[model samples]
Target: MNIIQNPDSTSLKRTIEQGTADQRIAVLDIINEVRKNGDAAIKAYTEKLDRVSLRSFLVTEEEVEQAYKEINEELLTIIQEAACNIRDFHSRQKRESWMTTQENGTILGQKYTPLDAVGLYVPGGLAAYPSSVLMNVIPAQVAGVKRIVIASPPQENGYLPAGVLVAARELGIREIYKMGGAQAIAGLAYGTETIEKVDKITGPGNIYVALAKREVFGHVSIDMIAGPSEIVVLADDTAKAAEVAADLLSQAEHDERASSVLVTTSLSLAREVKKEVYKQLEPLPKSVIARSSIESYGAIYVTDTLDHAIDIVNELAPEHLEIMTEDPMSLLGRIRHAGAIFLGRYSSEPIGDYFAGPNHVLPTNGTARFSSPLNVDDFMKKSSIISYSQQAMLENGRKVAAFARLEGLEAHARAVELRLEDL
Candidate 1:
């Protein structure tokens, strides 16, 4: 990892992947085909891209049962327990519709409605993410979303990963589909004869999937255009080098584009962590990928003070921020921009990824400055409720009309005036 005394903004910025023109064109073609042909286009794309032909996209009960047999009982139990943890955590985020009646007989409030249906795009086959399944689905389910669908690309053997199937089954989600890429996204967004259109699409995917989500933004809701994984550790002299190095590597192994950075006040700690990072990298199975990530995007920034380090972390706005200073909680109020904040050495990044019960789907690539993690709110919609009483309307209707006409919206002013005239 590169060790620098003070890095500038140019050193921190990473280019967000927006896909190439050819990829965008390809995604558009796929989406149009799905719109024109529906199920046939999905089958064609599945056969061409996934190298598997299927008459049906739905995963049957028999396949799900077989998936259970393939997974060991212990793993199933762990998945079940993890699901409970996630459910318990997200249940705290559930909201109910609320209204407030004013003294003037006006009712003003907000109504929260869970989306009718949602499509979860799980990476398929060898790249299956069972944790993602738990993170994305449990929140939507908690939000009272009625129909939750799962879409995954099938392996060459014409089956989704057993772990993914088991995770979905644990959550009682049976509407699993064996499709992937932009085609699956299109099928979920536009609807096919076999697959129903979802109100929102959530989960991670490749460049094509990201591009497909961009194309279908107006047609349906999407989570966000997620970038590569990132981790920023704000530590001090009191922090251990080995633990810091290990936490950095946890995100590096995700992809070559992933970033692992350390901001510390102690120069000695930075030097020690740089050495420990390479030492730990030698035996990692994904060393090649991790090494590429570490060498290209990883760095250790040594600041003059802990406050300076905090400033750098806020500027970076990382996806995952771990505070390893002596007084981690004291600095929480200073941190304004982290998708997730893990305190203390024991609260590692992976704990939130799997068992710690927070949604792992977070904004990446500095988006934490303005975005947030995937939660129950992402699967729900909000409606503004306004019931104006005759007295209230008589009081404020002329003000409303003048305000509307001030904006040159004559119809808006007349609508309120007509209502007032009727009263």
Candidate 2:
């Protein structure tokens, strides 16, 4: 990791902005083809991109049963436990419809309704994340989503990952599709013969999947167009260099474009953490990817003060922020922009990613500045409830009509006037 002395804010901003125009164009073409040709286009892209011609897109019940037997009992136990933790955490975020009534015979409220069906895109092949299955599916389940299906790329052997299948089965999700990429997204947005159109699509994927989500956003609700994973560790002299280095590498190993940064007040700690990162990278199985990420996007900014460090963190609005100072909680109130926060040295980023109750699907590419982590609310919709008695309408209708007339909307004015005339 390179050490910089007070880097410029613009340079920091540039690291998180990802995706290319050509990539967008390619994804658009794939989406258009899938929209026009439907199931045939999905098969062609799956064969061409994933190198496997799938006979059937849906996973059978027998296959799901075999997946349970294929994985060991020990792993299954862990997945179940993790699912419970995720469910318990998200259950707290569930909301109920509320109403307020007035003596004037008017009622106003908001109704919370779960989405009818949702599509989950899980990346398969080399990238297999069963944790993602738990994180994305459980929230939808808590929100009472009726139909949930997963679309993952099939391997060269034309089978889904046993871990992913096992996780989905644990959540009672049966509809697993053997498809991926932009075509899978297209199929989900505009249904094919095999796949049903979903109201919303969630989970993370590569650039093509991200761009496809961007294209089909209006047609179907999407969680967010997630970028590469990123982590920013705000450490002080009290922080252990080795622990900070490990946390940074955890995110860096996710992808070659992943950004790992350390903003600290202590120059000595920054230098030590830099050396520790190099030592830890050598032993990692994904050292090449981590090394590439660290060299290109990772950096250690040694600020003159802790306040300055916090300022830089807010400016970056990282997906994950770790406060490794004397009192990590003391800084929590000051952190205005972060997808998820790890309070102390022990609260590693992976805890939230895997076993911890909180959702790991977070906003990336500085989206934490305005957006938020994926939750039960993402799978739910809200409708405004309005009811007016005859007396209420008789008192308010003329005012509403006059306002509509002022806006030159005669149709809106007449609608209110008609109700008023009946009253």
Candidate 3:
């Protein structure tokens, strides 16, 4: 990792940003072909992208039941516990369709209602993220969404991972489809003869899957246009360099494009953390990917003051941010941007990914500034509820009419005027 003493802010943004126009165009091209050809396009894309040839694209109830018997029971327990925690936390986020009455008998308020059905795409990439399944599905369940469907590619033996299936079963989500990538997203968004059309789609995938979601947004709602994984640690002299480096490499191992950066105020602390990152990176399973990520996208930038460190973090708007300074709370008010902020050494990023109560499906590639982590809100829709008595309409009718006419909407004005004409 290169040590830049007060590096340029623009350089940081250009380095870590994801989701460019070219990527968007490529994804759109794929989505268009899939939209045109339907199942045939899905078959071709699956074979081309995942290198798997499938005879069928659906996982039957019999198969799902058999998977439970095949896998060990111990792992199932862990998935169950995690599911309960996720479910409990999200259940708290449940909202109700509401209405309120004015003193003059005018009824008005916004109504919160869950989507009828939703689809989730769990990527069976380098590793199967079963935790992701729970993170995405339980929120929909909490939001009282009626039907929750999930789609993922099968392994070489044409079977889904036990952990994933187990997670789904725990959530009572029996709708599992044996399809993935852009095709899986297409299946969810447009609906196949066998698969049901969903009101929205959520979960994570590769660039192609993200692009497919971007294209299908208007047809059906989606989580976000996710990008590559990233982590930024804002550590000072008090931080344990070893733990910081370990957390950095954890995200790095995801892929070469993955990024891990550390900004601190101490030069000695910077050197120690750099050495610690290498020491930790040496004996790792995915060292090849991690090493390249740290060298190419990772860095140890030294800032003169804590404010400067906060500035860099805000500009980056990293997906995962860890603050390990002496007074981590001091910087809390200062941090204006980031997907999920990890405070102090104890609040590591992995906790949020697995055991922690918060949702781990965060916005990436500088989207933290605008977007938020997936929650019950993603699965629900809102409708404004309005009801006014005759007297109430007469009281506010003139204001409503003039306001409508100011926008050159005579019909809108007349609608209100007609309602109050008898008054």
Candidate 4:
């Protein structure tokens, strides 16, 4: 990992840019082809990219039941526990319709409505993630979305992973499709003979999938276009060097482009953590990827004070922030930008990623500055409700008509005038 005394503002800005125009064009072509060819395009692309030919895409109830028998009882128990935790947390974020009535007999309110159907894209094959299944599906269930469909790439054997199937079945989601990449996104957005068009799509995928989501956004609602995973550790002398090093490597192992950075006031601790990272990396199974990530994007920035470290964190707006200090909670209010905040030495990044109730699908590539983590609200929509009594319209109609005429919208003025003509 690179060690810098203090990085300038320009260098910080350059690290967060995610995708290129060429990538966008490539994904756009894939979306267009899928739109034109429909189910045939999806099958062709699945064969070319995933190296599999599929006669059918949907996972049957028999397959789901068989998956439960394939996996161990221990893992099944763990997945159930995680799902319960996720459901409990998101249930708190559920909203209710509300109304207010005035003495003039006018009623105003807001109605919360869940989307009719939602498409969830889960990475398949060797990169299967049951945690993602729980995180994505539970929130939609809490929001009362009835139709939840899943799209995942098929393995070499033309089947989804047992763990992935088990997770979806546990959530009572049986509509699993054997497709992935940009084509899966297209099928979800535009619909094919086998797949139904969904109102909203949510999940994380590679660069192609991200670009496809960007292309089909207006046609169908989507969650944020996520970038590579990133983590920023803010520490002081009180933090343990070994624990911090392990946490940094946890995110670094995600991908070759994933970022793991440490900003601290203690220079000696920074040096020690750097050494610990090297020691921990030697035995990791994904050492090559983690090493590349650490060498290219990882850094240790030594600041003058903890306040300076916090300032750097806010500027970076990392997806995950860990504060390891004498009093971790004391610095909570000082943090203004971060998708998920982990405090103290014990609160590592993976705790929130897997077991904790909070959603792991967070904003990436500095998007935490303005956006937020995926929640129950992502699957829901809101509509304004207004009811006007005859007396109320008679009392205010002419004023509305005069204001509309001032804006040169004569039709709007006439609409109000018609309501008040009898008065």
User: Can you give the TM-score per candidate against the true fold?
Assistant: 0.96, 0.97, 0.94, 0.97
What would the per-residue lDDT of candidate 2 be over residues 132-180, giving only the tens digit for each residue? 8999999999999999989999988888888999999888899999999
| Cα lDDT tens digits for candidate 3, 1-423 | 888899777568333434678877776776777677777776777777777776677777877788788768788887787777788788888777778887898889888888999999888844677898899998988888899899998776667887788778877888888788777887888876677789899998887787788789999999998888889999889998889889999899987888899989998988988999899888999999999888888888899998888889998888999999888988898888899999998998998898777899999888899999899999988999888898888788999999999999999999999878778
State the lDDT of candidate 4 residue by residue for 1-423, as single tens digits: 867666665555325545688888878888999999999999999999899999888888887888888999999999999999899999999999999999999999999999999999997766778898999999999999999999999989888899999999999998899899999999999999888899999999888888889889999999989888999999999999999999999999998889999999999999999999999999999999999999999999888877778889999999999999999999999999999999988899999998889999999998898999999999999999999988899889999999999999999999999878777
* 120-218: candidate 1 lDDT, tens digit per residue: 999765576899899999999999999999999999999888999999998999999999999999999999998889999999887888899989999
Q: With candidate 4 superimposed using the best TM-score fit, by how many Å does residue 210's alpha carbon deviate from the native?
A: 0.2
Model 4, TM vs. native: 0.97
Error of 2 at 200 (Å): 0.8
Q: How many residue pairs clash in each candidate?
A: 0, 0, 0, 0
* Total colliding residue pairs, candidate 1: 0
Candidate number with greatest lDDT? 1
Worst 10 residues of 3 by lDDT: 10-19
Clashing pairs in 2: none
lDDT of each: 0.92, 0.91, 0.84, 0.91
Please report the TM-score between candidate 2 and the true structure. Answer: 0.97
Q: Clashing pairs in model 4? A: none
The residue pairs in collision within model 1 are none
Weakest lDDT window of 10 consecutive positions for candidate 1? 8-17
lDDT of 3: 0.84
